[model samples]
Every structure is written in structure tokens, then in C-alpha cells.
Target chain A: MSESTAQNAGKLSDDTVPSALMDGEFLQQLRQQMYRFSLLQLDDPQLAEDAVQEALLGALRNARTFGGRAALKTWVFAILKNKIADTLRQRHRFVDADQLLRSDAEEDIVDTLFKESGHWHRQERPAHWENPESAIRDKHFWRIFEACLEHLPARQAKVFMMREFIELESHEICAAAEISVTNLNVILHRARLRLRECLENNWFIREG
Target chain B: MKKCRDITRLLSEAQERELTPSERISVKLHTLICSGCRNFGSQVDILRRISRAYVRGAADEPQREEDSGD
Candidate 1:
């Protein structure tokens, strides 16, 4: 707390970032960021591990070549992004529409949460989560959040991650997933609903 | 005012695209009195931000390797 500049150290705009990249400490930070980012994209644990390893090596060995034009993350993520794309191309992933579409069973889950008049049932209303940002700061919380995501249907999770994790534009996501703009919207909607419900019930409420 | 179900959907939709002016007003009014919807909206909003941060990988201690998302 005594050193004022220390707190601002994480900002990307700070020139110290590029210098930090060469230090062993920052390399470790870069690796964890890459691993988590890769997991969301590659989806396979082993493949994501490989991608992260390759990306880290690339960044470390070529540290001198990195231009300071982007944040350290933006640079590392670009390297890892190419790695994941290569992995996806090698494996030829599938995006199944039949599976991606909302099912009656899933709708039934949502239906039970709301009444015929579209009001929330007493049991399913959202409880206040003070300091919601802290949810990401806690590792156990992230594990619970990931478990909630794991509970979703595969295609639904895929669509959700495509938007949430990769930050793809809607039209690009729809095109990549081979679903209509409307269907993509519906899938993302349901994914958020379930995750919100799960986190509210299982994490935030318990914490509060 | 929109129903809870409708408002919930709107909060979620707001994540995907811009809300219409009417839709925006309806949500503001509904969430103002509705604690449930208000909390729901905030959580959904946080979910978007934190989920991105999670991928961006917040600084934290290492945990056991667990496979999540596909």
C-alpha cells in the first residue's frame, strides 16, 4: 500500500509490461492466462495444455520480436489463438444444430422457474450478490462457475463460450456455429439463464 | 412494466445486443421495484465481465487441473 505506482503495475498501457514479460514472474502469469483462455476455446483439457505450452514457448523464445503495439495479453493471446485454430482444424470439430436448438426439457426447466404469466416463482428470484466482481477473484468460485457451465448441453455451452469466452461478434458466431441469428440468440439466452440460476442458488446465496 | 420472465429475457438479451428504447424503459421500471430482477440483471452483467476476466485469467494461485467447457 505504501508504493503508489505498484498498484498501477498491471495496466497494459504501462511500459513496464513489456519489460515484465522477460522476467520469469511475468512469464508465469502469461502462461496461466493463456491456459485458461485456451481451455475455453479448445475445450479439450489435454489439447488446451498443448496449445498453452506451444504458445508460451513461442512467446518466451521470441520475446525480442514482440512489438509493444498491443498489451502483453493481446500479443500472447494472438499466438495462442493461432495455436488453438490449428488444433481445431486438425481435429475438425462439429457444431450440431439439432443439439444446439433449445429442447422441450430445457424449456421446461426455464418454465418451472417462471409462472404462466412470466413472473418469477418465489424460489427462483435472484438474491443480491454484493461484490459480484470478487466471484472471478476466488478460485473456488471459478470452479463452481465452471461446474455450472459444465452442466449445460454441449452445443449450448459451445455457443455460450463462443460468445462469452472468445468474444466473437454475433453474426460471426452464428456463421461459425451454422445457426441462424435467432437460434444463436436463443442458445446464448438459455445458457446465461441456467448459469445465473446455478450461480445464484449454488454460490452467491450460500455465500450471502 | 414487463413480467419477471419477460424482464429476465430482456436483461439476457441486452448482453447480446442493444435494447430498444421501450425495452430499456420497461427494464428500468421493472427492475427498480423488483429486487429479484435487479439482482438477476446485475448478476448477468457481472457474469459477462467476470467470464471475460476468467478467460483473460485473473491472477491467482494454481488449482488442481480440472476440465471445464467444451
Candidate 2:
């Protein structure tokens, strides 16, 4: 048997077969998701489109060597993430003045969680999350997590994603989001607090 | 005494930058007595781990199989 056939025979299933890469609707949905993710990071529609196009092209060009160890979506996202990082680095010099001036309109969720004396509000105290590590292995837990992430205010969600998901440095995020270091910290703090509370309410407490 | 509010912010900032010696001591002391803030700190750390796992496509794995439409 040829090399490709031999490789297929060793696999448990055909999900990773190169032919699976040709699913038109699947590819289209992947492209849209990539574009949405890129847009969230880049914040410019044109740049996001170009980054997705480039990433998809790069994925296709290297499709032959895709060993199927990772799901194709994961592989594609890895490529798009690199593409976004490159775009962010290159566009650093042209900081949009408008972004800097955008109002911090999102009400501070952190403030409400605390009180006048800086104590946790009685009702807002974070309860213990039992065996959170195990929740990582539970697929339903992630859906709740994503829902909480989605509920964050747009600015908070963007800054939080850049810090936690993209793993951007503080300086890189400040530059990209056109915000001060202090502002970034506050946004991250609020995001974390909100996400923590959200997961506590929606998942941990519910599960308990 | 450092309030849980400030202690939690310090914990979050700890993720981004090194805390001052005084800030570190304050957090250590506060969380020692405060269960809520203590839980907050670990939850945020778990948030970081979950975010990393999500990016690595942990959450997408099952969805991918469903999308295969065999």
C-alpha cells in the first residue's frame, strides 16, 4: 500500500482523512469563525478579512503534511492566531487615535461586587468552586464558560481575550487597544471578577 | 486591614506584573483570613488555565466530530 493508505489504515477512523478537508460547508463555517475571531482581535474589518484569507491559504498549502493529530479546526485556529499576532505587531505603529478616545462606558462590575468599605458584598462573596480542575474535563462546563465570556461587555471581553486567550503582554495589549496600562489592568480585573462570578453562579453553584 | 476588594485587585494584578513587597504581604495576610478572596484568587488562576485550554482547542474537539457529518 502507498504511504497515505498505510497511514489511514493505522488510524481508528477516517475523520482525519485528507478528503474530509474538502467539505465546502464545513470550510465556509470555519472561514466565518476565523474571520470573527480575527475581527475581534484586529478590530478592523479589512485587516481581519485579509488575515483570515492568508491563514486559510496557508492551511491549504500545508494540508498535505497535516498528520491529523489535532483536529483540523484547532490546526487552522493556531495558524490564524499567528497571523493575528503578526498583524498586531505590524500595526502597532499606527495606533488609532479614535480607539483611545472611545468612552469607557461599560459600568464597573467590580465596584458593585464590593461595598463602600471595600468589603465583598454579602450576596456577592465568591463561593468555593468544588474541584474546578475536573470541570476542565467536562465539556458542558465549557459551554457555560463560553456563555459567561460572551456575557461580558464588549470592551471587557476584547481586553480579557487579548490577555488570557491571545496571551498578549500587557504592553502589547495597551498598544493594540489604545489604552493605558492602568486602564488595561482595570479592564482585566473587571473581566476576571465578572467571569469568576458568572461561572460561580452558572456552573459551580448550579452543579453543587 | 486590607479589604477583600483591594486584595482581589492585587491578585488580578499579580497575573500581569510582580506585586510590590507591601502589596504581596497585604494579599498574603488578607487571603489568609478571607475565604471569599481566597476563592477569588484560585478561580482567576483557573480562568487563566481554562482560557489557555480553550485556545488549544479543548472545547472544540467534540464539536468538530459532530460537524464531520459522516
Candidate 3:
């Protein structure tokens, strides 16, 4: 090597070593965040615990190659997210969306709506809209809300939890969910709209 | 400044604290002018708060698994 290039290479090893990349505190925070995140996704405490264990070990084993582009949490979560996605993908055994939607052509969503809750706009506007103290006092309101959230489609539910509950960035969510930014936005939008409609019809309107 | 529809669109972004300064200003201006949009924004904020609360509650609940016919 040239003398100057050789000198710079020697300084690189002195200045920074890749072996010193791992930060124990950073990894612990990553583990906690991933645990909370996985809990929201799986809705099962046992599954979340198992997932966090796997993610922590994965991060530990791969720490040497970590490039440190994003925040440590983001990097670890990116790995953990892939693990969660793979688990979900294995569990998913359903017909394609288009085929399911097409074959259920006779299943009128309007009829389903009518049976579930009538004339959504015709119902009285909720007073709880102004004061959530009443909503907090009413356990039944939350019970229905939880049911609606649980009934949401899997991908929509995942995106909603990642963004709304975990407060993860949209880019991170898009990366974790293996979806395009546009699709992630669409999923979140639909999830919120459905949640709003469901809550309005079931708790807000019915209570009124 | 954002219009009412734009303000509503930003509601989710705002809840996640993802809105840029300019976007926040746009939504702020729209909400200031439109009562309907303000009410809509309030409801969205409430929804976000409740979501977080519910998640916390779920995390704290005793671990129990029932085969609810999944």
C-alpha cells in the first residue's frame, strides 16, 4: 500500500473498532421496545415473550455486522419485525383477497351494515364526543372498542397497532410490515375509518 | 394552509407525531377556521389516546389464553 493510505488504515483501527459496536444499554432498550411492539401484534403475552427472546438473541448474534445507519432500536426492530412477519406468513392460510372478495359477491356489505347498526348518520351524535370522562366511566364502551379492533383484518390491525399504539414512524412500519409506503398509508387510513365507524355505531350512537 | 380534508388526513400523522412543521401549521390553520374539522380532530385525538390506554391495559392484564374459537 502507499504510505499515506497505509497510515490512514492504521488510524482506523485505533479510532474505531467494529467489535466495540454492541451497546448493552442500547440493546436492553431495544428489547423492551420490541417486547411491547410484539405484544401489540400478537395480543398474547406468551407469544410476545417468546418473540422478544428470539429477537434479542438475533440482535446479539448479528451485532458485529450492524452498520449503525438508523437508531439502534430501529435496526433491532427491523430484524424483529422480519421475524414477526415470517411467523404470521406461515400462519396465514387463506384465499387471495381478490378471490375472497369476488366469491363473496352475494355477501352485501350494506346488508351486513343494516344488521349490525342501522342508518349510521340518523343516530344521535354522542355527548361523549365532548367529554371522554363519560367514556372512561363506561367499561362497556371500551369492551366494544376492543372487539372492533380485534375483528379488523390482520394486516390492517398490524399497521394500526404499529403506528397508533406503538407510535412507530410510518417508514418503520412500512419496512416492518413488508408493505409499500402507499399501501401502509391505505391500511392505516382504512383501519381508522373502520374504527371510527364501528365505535360511532356501537358505543357512541347506541349509548346516545 | 391545508383544507378540511387535508387536515383530517393529517390527523393520523399528527397523532404519531410524524407531521412536519409545515404540515402541523397547515392543519392548525385549518382547524382554527373550521369547527367541523376541529371536532373531527378532537375525536381522532381521543381515539389515539384510548388506543394507547387499551394497549397498556392489555399489557398489564394477567396472562391467560382461552381458545375463543380462533
Candidate 4:
């Protein structure tokens, strides 16, 4: 795990936004980044676009009050996160993590992975994945990863993004998403499991 | 003896929860001999690393024009 540490993957590289807020080029660039992040987190291009616009507008409206404590990129991202949360709330897309634990259907997927004798089903056996570290450097791989993430059920994807994307600690996710610790772990475990299955099916084997 | 399925469960659980000492020993034993389980562990590790990078790299936002600024 140490050779492959990506958690807290480092802060936004450029903290400086133009002192001139609303510089067409800068906002334009920032808008695109915001939109991409929102889309990945929300998986709805239209809604993601809306969230970026709202976030930018809100940031500009309150631009004067910007105490320089946080990097501009961090500040903007903070606003965008709130916009995304609000959008998810309005859409009723937020999942109660505890509910995920009760969904017996998930157990069916896990069950199918093994035979009655508890051996790997041929299809479920882990195969040689081309070095994933190399794949991470390729821009196209991120798109494939995003596509795999989008394949997750709405609630599962949301929770997964919160813990993994936002990099919130498990306890924080439980508080914010109103899920119990057990439920949070269960959801996370499933997300990781399903994501591995998805990438294996969609990316790894396909390339092989 | 832990089955491959059992070892796989522990591998995923290790990502989110602490494994009991017995569970750790079982996984250590299984993965030591099992190439598939080791691949499984590294695959999950890969997934975790890439996901974090993908998220944080959004701050950099490569200069590609895909949206209409709508």
C-alpha cells in the first residue's frame, strides 16, 4: 500500500487565482475544472454544469469577503462542494449509508463471486492487471475510471466519492451523510469491491 | 484453512475495517501462497491510489475545452 499511496493526493497545485476575479480566461479555466469535478462526483453532466455555474456566481458575489486564509482554488472548491451537496439534497440523491447495509441484493453479488466450496468462480478470479500506477498517469485512464465509477448505484457512488474523492475520514462521512459507522464501512467495502469488479471487467480484461 | 473466498473478504475488509489478529494471520498465510489473492490486494491498492489522484488532480484541470461554459 505504501508504494501506492494516493490518499490526500496533495493539495491544489496552484493556489493563486488572479487577483482580478472574473478574469474571463481564469474563470473559464476554473469553470471547466469545477464542471469536471462535479460531473465525476454527481455523474450528471447537466447538473454538474449547473453546480459549477452556481458556485462561480456565488464566489464572485462574495469575492470581496474573501479573506486570503485559504488558497483561491481551495476556496472555490469549498464553494463547489457545497453546491454539489445542495444539488444532491434537492435531487434526493443522498444515500443514508445505513440503508446500504440492509440491501440484501448486494450479498447476491458477493455470493456469486465464489462457488459453494468457497473457491473463486473462474470469472471472479483476479488476473494480471497491467501496472495500474502507469495507467494512473495516462489521462484517458481517468476517463475510464470515471466511467467505471458512474456504473455504481447512485447511493453507492455518492458515498464512495465522499470518502474517496473528497477524502473525508470515515467518521466525517458518517456524520455528514447520516450513516452509522457500520453502514459506512459496509458501503465503502461494497464500493471498493464493486469498483474492482467493474474495472476488471471493463478496463483490465478489455485491454488484455 | 481459509478459502480463497474468505481471504478475498478479508482483503476488502482491510480497506475499511481493522482485521482481527486471527484474520490477519489467515490472510497473511493465504496471500503468501496465493498469487491471485496478492493480485487482488494490489488491485485494490491501485484503485485506492488512482482514485485519490483523480480527485486531487481536478484542481489542476488540464487545459481541455469540452464544455460550452453553460
Candidate 5:
């Protein structure tokens, strides 16, 4: 466990609270954050919306045990993370964390090298690199990226998507993923490195 | 042992304004002298800008009240 995680764990164990009534406004805000959280995890806006609905129902039913020690948002995120995990587990048997990290690392290296060599730049410059201006026009590029992502283990993919695409705060990501701060950081680091390397060697240096 | 590449990994969070203080310092100082890290940092910065643009566009969506009327 990282120093920060150990610290967070201490804080969690130090305080305990039973239900504190959340007003309507609090609930609305909670719902919105959860919606975004789910969206980050699933990457499908509709699926994320559904996950929030399910999570909200779960929260409402379990409100009596809601500990006020942590902020309601934290508790709510914890629940939503579990819900997302459960959903993913049901849909995909398991995601191999180590393999996923390795694959991403491979791809990042490839992509980086590729870009460095100016192969992708020569291909027909993408109007936008991250999410091509026209996904249809850049379908091939996205397809390759997506295929690389699909090769990742589910948990790593989830962490990568949440941090990279969803842009969630690390603290919230830890809470949502129920991972320790160090583990979360490690996952994020591996994900970014792999993507960087992959993007460079494969897509960026395709011609090279 | 950490190398420039290893240190560069943390810059993604640093650029996102997400890294803790020590991390920010380590990544920042490393990039200053390491050409590989500098390039990596630039790439990450570019990606961050793109992500921010996408997220912002997500909000460019019409207001709830206006959409309800439509």
C-alpha cells in the first residue's frame, strides 16, 4: 500500500457513522457524478445512465447503513464502482491485469516510435488525434486503437478508460475502483506508458 | 531503478494537474533535462488538451430546460 492509501485507510477506520439524511439536492449531485463515473467505466453513455439508475436504487435501499464518516459522495462512488465491476464481470468473465498492462506498454512503445518516424503524420493527417474529427473517416485508426484496447485485461482497461478518457480525479478513481492509491497509480502509469509506446511504434511509425 | 521513460509515466498525471506534490516535482525536473521525457510530456500535454476539448464539447450540449421544450 502506498503512503497515501495507508493514510486513507486510517481515516476510514477512525470514523464511523450511520445514515445521515441526504437532501434532494445532494442526491441530484450524487446522481450526476455517478452518471459520469459509470460513463467513464462503460464508455457507453446509455449503459452508464443505466448503471447510475441501478446504483441509485441500491443506494436508496441501503441508505440506513450509509456511514457519514466519509462524504456521501465517497460512499456513493464506492457503491457505483462495485456496481460497474459486477456488470463487467457478468459480461466478460475476467480481465487479466498483468497481461493488459504488458499489451498497453507494447502498444505505447510501437505508437510512439511510429509517430517519431513520421509515418502516421504522412498517412493523411488526422483532423484530431485523440478522437478523430470524423470517426468514420478515421475508422481504420480507431479500429486499430480499439483492437489494442480490447486486448487489454478488463480491469486495466477500466482503469485506463476511467483515468484517460473519463478524466476522473485519482482519489475518486481509488474510491470507485476500490483500489489502493499506489495500485491505482501503478495501473494508470502502466496504461499511459503502454499507450504511448504502442501509439508510437505501431500507428506512428507504421511506414518506418 | 527508474529511468527517464519510467519517470515520464508520471507526467501524464502531472500534466492533468493530478499528481501529488513530490510526483509533480520529480516529473517536472526530469523532463527539464531528459529529451525523451520532454517529448513524452509534450505528447501527454497534447492528449490532455484533446480530452479537455472532448469533455467540454460534451457540455456544449443544450441546456436541460431548452432540450425539454424542444
Candidate 6:
């Protein structure tokens, strides 16, 4: 055990976990953050609460085994992410028929950005974004990005998050969302278009 | 014959799967003339990168507070 602990510690970027992780107030804050993160992805309060509870319990049970390798928050979130995935998989199997239809019935945003001739709308054309790479390191940029993500229609945001943030394969997302490959592509296409437009309007263009 | 709208869909689809030769060719040809489609392609790529960065940064929030305090 000590051998493995030393090896893990060596492999990690941070050798020690901060004491703040142990503070009661900090733990409470972490719990709230986890709930918000899960809710954003899961979009169901009950499931989000259950996922957070299970993750926290698992973290507590495995606390000694944590070995001061990764940040406690990161470790907890890793567990929470797994919990959310499992919950999604389970829910996917029993997804309500009405919910599935509703998700499919939602109107597409693509039509608004394109003319009847399938060309870009004059006012909707994408503007040149200078140095978008530099925005990744800016905290304010992330805030705007998150807001833009939140602005996405629920189904679009959920599918987009599963693909991009959770790093799930397209097939996996299709299976989870009960969407066909073609349908998945359309949803992703719409999501990207809107997201690009939102960030361009809110951040990049505003900066210029 | 592909318009900017069709080219943008192909661009986004490329993220999910391999585009067929003709589809790829159409996108390549269309984007060459259409600055708007070209910009859309790069912006979507940026969206993917930003998403990954966001995931990594999510857990760093509290840590950032601690670092500033120290």
C-alpha cells in the first residue's frame, strides 16, 4: 500500500491535498457545486441530488485510500461524473415515451440562421473572432461560455455536453439519448451553430 | 452547388464521423470561396477545445481560491 501510495503521489501534479478540503464549510460549498454541475447535466433535481449523495458517500468511504494525489475536489468530481453516467444509462433504458417525443418535436434553430436558398443570413453571418485561443485562460470568458451553454435548449445542451464535456463517443451519445445518428448530427449541428453565434455575439465581438 | 448552410452541416458532421469523399470535397470546395463557412468551421473547433478546457477548469475553482489565499 505504501509503495502504491508513493507511486501515485509521484505521478500526480500535486503531491499534497490541501487542508481546506477538510474544512466543514468548504465541504458544504463543494457539495453545492457538485449539485449544480450534476443538475446542469442531468436536468433533474432528484437524480442530481441522488448522484451527489452517492458520490460524497463513496468519497468518504474511500477517503483514506485517496492518498493525497489529486485535489480532493477533482477526485470527488470524477466519482460524481461516473455516478451521473450510470444514472443516465439507467434512465435511458426507461426513458418515458412522451419525453422522447417532446425532445424530438422541439423546433430547430437552423432555419433562422439560413435563408430559404440555404445561404447564410446577412445579419447572421459569423464575424471574424481574433485570437480565440487567448480566451481559454480568462475566467471571465468561461463565465460567458457557461452562460452561453446554459442558453442552449435543454436537449441540445444535454446532448452537446455528453459529446464534448463528458467526452462520450457519438455512438454512446446516440444510445444514451435514444437518437439516430442522423438526428444526433442535426442536434449537434444546431447546438454548435447557436453556441458559436452566442459566443461571437456575447464575448468575441463584444471584446472587439 | 453546396451552399454555406449545407457546408456548415457537413463541417459539424465531420466532428462526429468521417465524411465521405464527395462530402469532404464539397465542403473543401465550398469553404474555399465562403469566408463565413470557413469561420464557422474554425469556431466550432474552438468550441470543442473550450469545452475540454472548461471541464478541466471546473474542479479548479476552489483550488483557485486557496492559491490566491496563499
Each candidate's number of clashing pairs is: 0, 0, 0, 0, 32, 0
The Cα RMSD of model 3 versus the native structure comes to 13.2
The residue pairs in collision within model 3 are: none
Question: Measured against the native two-chain assembly using Cα atoms, what DockQ does each of the candidate structures obtain, in the order listed?
Answer: 0.30, 0.49, 0.09, 0.34, 0.13, 0.48
Error of 2 at B20 (Å): 2.7
lDDT of 5 by residue, B13-39 (tens): 574456778777777776566566666
Whole-model Cα lDDT of every candidate shown, in order: 0.71, 0.78, 0.57, 0.69, 0.54, 0.77
Q: Pick the candidate with the highest DockQ.
A: 2
Across A1-208, the per-residue lDDT of candidate 3 in tens digits comes to 2344335444444224333224455445556767867876765677677666666555545444423413334445666666665554444332346533542332343123222332223232222364565665466767788788877766567678767655667666655556667666556655665676677667766653
Best by lDDT: 2
Q: TM for chain B in all models?
A: 0.77, 0.84, 0.61, 0.77, 0.54, 0.82
List where candidate 6 sits over 4 angstroms from the true fold. Answer: A1-18, A57-71, A93-108, B58-70
Cα interface RMSD of each candidate: 8.3, 3.3, 12.5, 6.6, 11.0, 3.8
Candidate 1 local lDDT, A115-140, one digit each (tens): 88888888888788877766766878
Query: Candidate 4 falls in which docking quality class?
Result: acceptable
Q: Taking chain A by itself, what TM-score does each prediction score?
A: 0.64, 0.78, 0.46, 0.60, 0.40, 0.75
Reproduced native contacts, each prediction: 0.53, 0.53, 0.11, 0.40, 0.04, 0.47
Off by over 4 Å in 3: A1-49, A52-128, A205-208, B1-4, B17-22, B58-70
Query: lDDT for model 4, on a 0 to 1 scale?
Result: 0.69
* Deviation from native of the Cα of residue A190 in model 3, angstroms: 2.4
Better of 3 and 5 by lDDT: 3
Q: Which 10 consecutive positions of candidate 2 chain B have the poorest summed lDDT?
A: B61-70
Model 3 vs. true fold: TM? 0.51
lDDT for each residue of candidate 4 in A20-76, tens digit (9 for 90 to 100):
343567667767778877986677787787777777655655555333322455667
